[model samples]
Target: MACKERSKGDSRDGDDTWRNTSLAAAPASRELGKAWILKRLVHHAPAIFHSFDFPAFELGNAFEDINVQFTEHGYILVGRSQYEAAEGPAALAPTFAAFKDNLCSVLVVNGLEPVPHETVVESSKTATLHRMKTWRGEGVNLLCGAVMEPTRGILVAQQIADDDRWTYSATSTQRDRMLWFERVYLPCGRKCVARMLLVRRPTGVATSPCAPHWKPRRRGIAATPSSLHRNRLQRRGRDSREDGMLVRVRGKILLY
Candidate 1:
């Protein structure tokens, strides 16, 4: 889900790289089911969202369902998996809020006043494309397609990280840590900090688009050879010093 530059002549229409690459086309009925499934999944992560007191929400349940679909689909469509995996589910609220805030920051960085989140949330179809493009120019990689939802609105974004990894510096404060590379280093160096922002569209709408690839039955189930290969891949290079960190990062995150 790492963001990459779109090829030249790529239409900034709603159907640009973000939409074409991440979203799956489904009937209204299927979409409802998907939403239901997502809601159920988020409920599983109670500790992550502090849902214990808030009986209306279930953070873990939401994450579990989204993870399943993301793995099957090959990219995350909703929620912040990377942050959640690292900091737990409560991280989603701030991470998503930060994502929105950063979009406005990018606009300001590029010499424009920050657009209000509400305004952006209510942006016209064409304006949505413009905002997304603006974000891309600022080094944000949007990975999700435009998802029109009744409760949450439209969601469109990419998974992104700072491309210039070498310039990053450590900080004493957590907020400082998050903003150090993104705001101070990159901006001072006249570089863009990586980010992702999803576009929100009107609700109850369906449009014509090619459907996403379906997961085959065989691929869903684990086979002996595949399992063995996966185990080997998990354990491979553990003894080698250079490969230790590589294995740690990839291994800690359970894709399944």
Candidate 2:
């Protein structure tokens, strides 16, 4: 479960580790090739930016479809589609079935470099209300709507104001899920841009790589494997159990 080594042009961060998305859907082995994901945790992506900037991290060179997973307590990066530009039906991004029939989800993280962003407790609030009442394999109550950001990678978003009523309500944690906006900041950046967030394409995963793969090489992990993804879960795993997807510029992540 480790295949992150892109070269040919080389960007900078050499050995940008790779070994995620396991427990089945296997592949990778040219020495860990690249490009093989399976309906990442069922599915939950499709534009829905509402905010997070730079034209959504410039779609980090068209995502490139990725997958990652690390467990013991934390790690999950899953990004999808847009493969370097287009291939068919404009590469599936009409907001992928209207945010999976209006269940909405988007997550971004990183506040203190490897550890400190409130200890990455599944984005807090009792682990996002026990992952909105668990069971996303289809339904435990369909994750109403969310757009959580953990911190540090230049997520300015949230500038809605005509009178600002972008609320669909539901917040005791998971009342069929509809939180849409929850932010907590404190990261400037130099080496921990901790990128990832460009979303869309959810018919139950199998794609959306942690972005930043223009092929000139250099970015691995979300866009870095998403700008060098931040799905990093070391909070309690002691070493690294694996649970990641890799972010880019837009939004949407599913952790474990």
Candidate number with greatest TM-score: 1
Candidate 1 local lDDT, 6-68, one digit each (tens): 334644333322222122234454344334333322322222222112122212222111111
Candidate 1 regions with alpha-carbon error over 4 angstroms: 1-95, 100-154, 158-228, 236-256
Q: Give each model a TM-score.
A: 0.22, 0.21
Local distance difference test scores for all models: 0.25, 0.24
Q: Candidate 1 versus the native: TM-score?
A: 0.22
When summed lDDT is taken over every stretch of 10 residues in candidate 2, the lowest stretch is: 156-165
What's the lDDT for candidate 1?
0.25
Candidate 2 residue runs with Cα over 4 Å from true position: 1-51, 55-83, 90-95, 98-132, 135-233, 238-256
Provide the clashing-pair count of each candidate structure. Answer: 23, 65
